[model samples]
Target: MDNTVEQVNVLCIKWGDKYGSDYVNTLYSMVSRNLSRPFRFICLTDEAGGIRDEVEVKDIPKIGFKDFDEKHPWAKAHGWLKLTCFANPLYDLQGPTLFLDLDIVIVGSLDKFFEPEGDFLVIKEWDKSDATGNTSVFRFEAGAHEDALDYLKQDANKATADVRNEQEYITQFVDRQNKLKYWPEQWCRSFKRHCLRPFPFSFFQQPRIPEGAKVIIFHGKPHPDDALRGRSGKWYRKVLPTGWIAEYWR
Candidate 1:
């Protein structure tokens, strides 16, 4: 690795027991293999006991909501805590920072993500026809979007009531400033939407990775682990064991 090359930041957050240290460790391994650019892998979490030493561990930045609690009913359902990543002066992290959900699998090169021209870029929601974006994969300057967090802090109640989730809130805020942009549709793909076969076909076929996809997001159900073992969360959806996940998910 060339020390003179500019390094970018890759960030992920883990708060609850829904995901374990293995998720963070494997994510770091996968990112290390896929990204050609000199990069720093950072994990913001409440517990860092089992995380690998190579990853720069940091406490999750606080959003300062008066009644904020990760285990609270509303906060548990919505990803409000992710807003903390937008806090101004985010723990000395600077330049283009890419935030990825812990459940995604990186299958292709990541160098091109930084080559795009955009202040804020996210995955356009595959299910919605509106301008809303999926925050599973997004990139922005480390401290560029503090206003979005500030707005949420001003009134947590109204903010939670107005939007369905944190991604929608941030999308609406950035879009209001005319700075919102999306990655190419083929880049970040949803496993449920793009990979799994439909209904009857799913019973016989194993899931396949889409062409030109860099990251495969395991959003709602059938996470990477489940797919690797052929466990479909739904009774109606039959998913066969996918061997390819082992090839890239680490």
Candidate 2:
């Protein structure tokens, strides 16, 4: 490790009572094990009671649109709290920042994420043709994309009027300006789409990490722990024994 190297910020958010401290703690461990570059790990959350000591903790930043007249359910419905990372002058820390969802599993090197040159980089939506971002793992220079949140403050109704969630709104807005870029196709793989076998085959084959995939995203059902036990929430999509998750998801 270079003592004089600049420290990169790795950010995650946890709010409400859905995810316990274990989720955040595990994420930090995985990140530490995978990243070799100097980094400052931070978690912006409402309840930081159970997080480990090594990780820096901060309260979730307040957004500008708190009691808007329009029915903007980004907070209540979708995981909109993530947008706070784009807030200009975010918490005093500055430089390249990489944001990861608490539910993802890090199985490969993360140093390349911060190495790539781009205005804004995110996981391309697995199932979209119109340049939608998944936001599971995204990176941007601090204070570079304040416009994402500024639009919501200007007119929450008009900003999110047609979009269903925050990712769609943010991706569409930035993509239009040519600031949005996507990670290499194989870098970020979805557990449901890439790991789990097809419907019938899924019943017998265990979920495995795709070659060259650095991170596995558990977006909806069957979390990292769920995969360890070979439990696929649905009957159609089966998960057999997979030893890799047990070895990696510590």
Candidate 3:
């Protein structure tokens, strides 16, 4: 390890009303509790009213597409707004940055995330066989990925016409240049895949953290709050009240 102290950054983005202030507040708390290194907690948000002062709030970076409309089907289809993180110069603060989605629950030490060697790091899709990556938890140098933004701006409509989503676009863009990489197989995990008990066992048992998991992602429905209340977002999936969530979710 280097003798010099470095400023690690933990970043989160909140765009629309889909997530409220509580989500950002709790995520900040969870990160503050789990990370051992000295770090700056940042929230890129449109509304920063309810976030804690400890978290540095900045306006969400724009990708220079003034016509970008979130309500448009193509833009909404993928998390297109998240592409703003690729803005070159990215608001003064620049260094190794770990971008986390607001819905994740951190369960283990995060110091290791900054220790990895890579120009970019993300969770490999839990379902795909290809090199596609999930953007839920990704790491990259502050200004390194600006080319992805530039590529999107060249022809906004045409760029997304054949693509699945932003992650696909980013992975393909970086993969072409051989800069794409994934987190260690076990560090980042899915709640339903690794934590939830299956079938009849699910009825009898409560969700438990997987061994060695550092982060748990709640991708679709059954958010952390939903899990705490035992309200499975889907009618088919049963989510019993997970009291353990309260312990870590803050």
Best by TM-score: 1
lDDT of 3: 0.84
| lDDT (Cα, 0-100) at 71 in candidate 2 | 26
Models ranked on lDDT = 1, 2, 3
lDDT of 1 by residue, 88-188 (tens): 78899999999999999999998888888888999999887877899999999999999887777787777657679989889878998999999999999
Local lDDT at 128 for model 2: 90
Error of 2 at 226 (Å): 1.4
Q: How much lDDT does each candidate structure score?
A: 0.88, 0.85, 0.84
Q: How many Å off is the CA of 227 in candidate 3?
A: 0.7
What tens-digit string does per-residue lDDT give for candidate 3 at 1-250? 7787688888888877889989999988999888877888888888888888898999877666664433354554467777777778878768989999999888888888998898889999888887789899999998888888777779877776766888877876788889988999889989888888999888878998988899999998889999988888998888889988898888
Question: 1 or 3, which is superior by lDDT?
Answer: 1
Which runs of model 1 end up more than 4 angstroms from their true locations?
1-4, 69-73
Top candidate (lDDT): 1
